[model samples]
Target chain A: MTAITVDRLHKTYLVPEREGGLRAAVGALVRRRRREVHAVTDVGFTIEPGEVVGFLGPNGAGKTTTLKMLSGLLHPTSGTATVLGHVPWERDRRYLGQMALIMGQRNQLQWDIPVLDSYKLNQAVFRIPDADFKARVEELSELLALEELLRKPVRNLSLGERMKCEIAGSLLHAPQVLFLDEPTIGLDVAMQRRIRSFVAEYNRRTGACVMLTSHYMADVEALCRRVIVIHHGRLLFDGALEELVHRFAGDKTINVELADEHPLDPAALGPLVDGHAVERSATGFSVRVPKAETPRVAARLLAGLPVSDLVIEEPPIESVIEQVFEATSAEVDGG
Target chain B: MTGERLDADWTSGPRQAPGEGGLAGLVRHDLRILRTYLSLGVLNLVQYRSDFVLSVVNAVITLATQVLGLSVVFGQTTDLAGWGPYDLLVLIGVHFLIGGVLGLVVRPSMEAMMEGIRLGTFDFTLVKPADSQLLASVQVVRPQALVDVLVGLGVVVFGMTRVQASLSVVDVVLSLLTLLCGLVVVYSFILALSTMAFWFVRLDNVLAIFQSLFGEAGRWPVTIFPGWLRIVLTFAVPVAFAVTVPSEALTGRLTYTSALSAAGLALLFFAASRWFWFFALRRYTGASA
Candidate 1:
């Protein structure tokens, strides 16, 4: 069953324009200049129940804007979206009871109180039965390792700990649809991994659909199987992680090691593998070649040099996504 | 066309939680949620023990200033606008009482709401299952302002004892009723003012204008002010109804007409404020367009 379906969801904001100097400030009071920003344009996607989809985009690429539309915090300027069979922005109590949105940078917990008190407030807000609420809290605590952190005031906890509590509080109702906007942002590598694993475990346990946005490739690689990529208010690519790499990234990288310990001179491979970026490292050198040429290039390299070992791998997902956006901007600039 | 699209997909239909969709059910659910907010507020107050002490001191200082000011005025005349010294004391006491309620829950809640909107945390409130207006109104708890409430009650009792008016059960009942009406009016006014934060986003100064005007002009009876100013305090901001009308009930000056008008105005403003709040919410969420 589809848990979320968005059709041509778009958002446009009228942002006021301003210029520097006292004269402009004075003029703004008299007649303000405003411009329209197409935050999200003709974006559409669908997520099945229990599917964890990564929403990938650069800063200000409308990833947050699209999430806001899905979570009911915003209304689309055009198109329509339904989460769990309810129009999100209508804000039906049943719809709200079944969905939760957690922003990593913005805290919804009471600042000066212990995390447990804020959790109780959520329990009240969602009207979860006492036994159910307690059971869910216990389950989430074990999943997120939140036992000790729940007793401390939010202000006292470190950023990573606070985010864990925030996530736990938002899920007190055991929402069926989870919208997480950079849930692991601004955290150390270890903490990010912890959050990512917890999210995956939670989704598995509850069969809840998860839509997450993050800058860290490790987060997407670890938690999401499918990703929806948006750039400049438009959908750029949407597919499985491997397919995103396959479609947009046309090159594969090969690392070739020589029998001797000395580093291989990158210039020696000239014309043999022309039009590929080759870099030399301590042990060996790696060459990026078009996906179709990878086999031929490796066969030629083995014949041309004293290659002891060779391995071919897809470029890192981060660089693939970067290439996608760069290509998009080039197209945008050309048009 | 969108309706057809929604219908095609909703094979299971939208789940209707039993006994939980109507108005009464919503109110009952929101009241329970309010209890949690209040408890959380008290927990916040417990964390900052010094704020309690400071609030008490602040209440004491405010009471002293009002008393000193009243005494200085009494030294000039035995009566102003047919209200004796004790009568005016009762009036000032009501002012503090109303102000105490506003300070405790009304004003702080509005300020919290404004801050939430500016910081984008208001989205949290909007997404909650409860009604957004009820959540915004009861989100902040101010136990420290209980000191001001108690002090105001004390002054009212003392002023009543000093004044030689033969009070009846109806007078006492009327006073309480008028006070309740005044509270509703002031809360509605502030709620309407706070809703402007959805548009202005920097309405602290605009809110302060209401605070300063009510504090300064609410001490005296509205009748003493010039004709145009009296109209404003009475109808513009409803300060006269918040302070003077309740004091009049205690001083044997309240008429049936005044009490009825206060109640009617309270109802009117409450409805207007509620309408404005949802309207603002629609605009904030970009739902109207």
Candidate 2:
């Protein structure tokens, strides 16, 4: 069975609004004004049991609202969603037992107690048997290198260390469906890689479904094969990560390394490098050309310049994703 | 980092689905959860050992002020209203005892919950696979408040000796039961007040106003208040039910109908507060959201 199925999910919030200053505030007292915030629109997707999917969106783009709904922490304004054969918003005890939602800034562990002690509380709440609890703790600590941090209170741990401990504590229950919202936020690059690898390993071993959202594209690149992107509370695209890059990235960058120095004017390179900005160094310059014109551009550069090593590459994924957002907003403004 | 297949570990006994566990089993489950929370609460208190010692000093000052005030009132007259000085002492002891119980767990947990709501840390609480009300009502405990409990007990014992009141086993049992009933109502009332944080996110002063009301009016018996004020104490905030009814039971002044009403109100308030809690939860626009 599919681990998650969401159809036409929507969430709207009515927030009070008033103009700044005393006159408007006094007027609002008599006639309150409220604006409807459509946090999540008619979004629909289904994830397989063992799939690792990336949820991509800019800030306030409804990524968090959708995750909160699927994790059963929210009631949708209108829609249907079932995770592991149960309606999420019903919040059945058994449903909650099989799933976990870990938000990076929000910690479930008790701050004043040691990390292991907080896990013990989870052991009680989740009704984990002794043997399994012990084994899971041992495995998780070894995986997270948390043996040293387990005995110290959470407040004493650094941001990265506390995040490690927090993730370990959330996993002690061995939830089948894991929702990680920006789990690698505010960590150094090395720590981010460690968390990303751990999450991949955990998902592989248990055959659990993992849905993750992050502002760091490295996290999405390292862990997720498929990505679903949303903007303005609406779905923009859902496909393989490579397909996303191929669909939005119409231009390929061609880099050339010259064996000998060549004094060449960028204007003399002709129309192939005309519109694009060519980044120039002492040896060679790199220019972006349309995917169809890469071969023509590469041949012309080779015949025209001193003999050099040439390479053609796709644009970086960050620029590709940024282009996707920019194109959508341009459509919105023009429409 | 290990490539070892964890397939065997996934289907193990750690994830026990909700089964046909009987009511007794459910009670045991809840009791275990409560014990875990209590232990964690104690561990937290242990970290702040100086706070515990300071609570003792605060307790001593509070008791001294109460005694000095009682002395001034008793010095001028043998009784206020229809109650003697010793009877009033019993009422004062009951007030301290009830307040101590609330300060121990109820007040601390409510404050923590409110702060969590304000900061959006309450999302963790909503995601737990347990009764949200029970979890929210007891997440933080302060054993430092036990000083008030001990002082209250000491005053009750001393007052009984001075009055030389003859008490039977049934009288003691009945008073204890009434005291339990009174506490239930008080807990529910405070919970309802705290639940307002869902709609009014910045209600830090609400509790302060409530404390002042209970502190000033609860010192004298509800009977001494004006008619409107007495009704308010008995029903609105219910400080009278929490302190006066238990004191009445101990002093042989309780009527059977009054005793019955206390039990009824306790159940009604508990149900209403529970309903209100879930209703407010649905309205909770999370700070993060």
Best by lDDT: 2
The candidate that wins on DockQ is: 2
| DockQ (model 1, Cα) | 0.31
Candidate 1 collision pairs: none
Q: Name the regions of candidate 2 deviating beyond 4 angstroms.
A: A272-275, B1-8, B13-25
**Residue range A1-335, candidate 2, lDDT tens digits:** 89999999999989999999999999998998999999999999999998999999888999999998888888999989999998987777778877888888777777777888889888888888888888888888777789999989888999999999889888877888999999988899999988999899889878889999998999999999999999988999999999999999989999988776576766776564656778876788788888888898888878877747899998988999999998998997899
The digit string of per-residue lDDT tens for model 2 on B145-240 reads: 877888888887777777656778988888898899989998999899999999889988878877887788777777788899878888888877
Clashing pairs for model 2 are none
Error of 1 at A25 (Å): 1.4
Q: Write the per-residue lDDT of candidate 1 for residues B1-119, one digit (tens) a residue.
A: 01111111112222334127688777778778878887677657777689889988888898898889888988999888988989988988898899888887778888988888888
Worst 10 residues of 1 chain A by lDDT: A262-271
DockQ of 2: 0.53
For model 1, how does the per-residue alpha-carbon lDDT over A227-299 read when each residue is reduced to its tens digit?
9999998998888999999898889999988888755556767766875778877667888999999899999
For model 2, give the RMSD to the true fold: 2.0
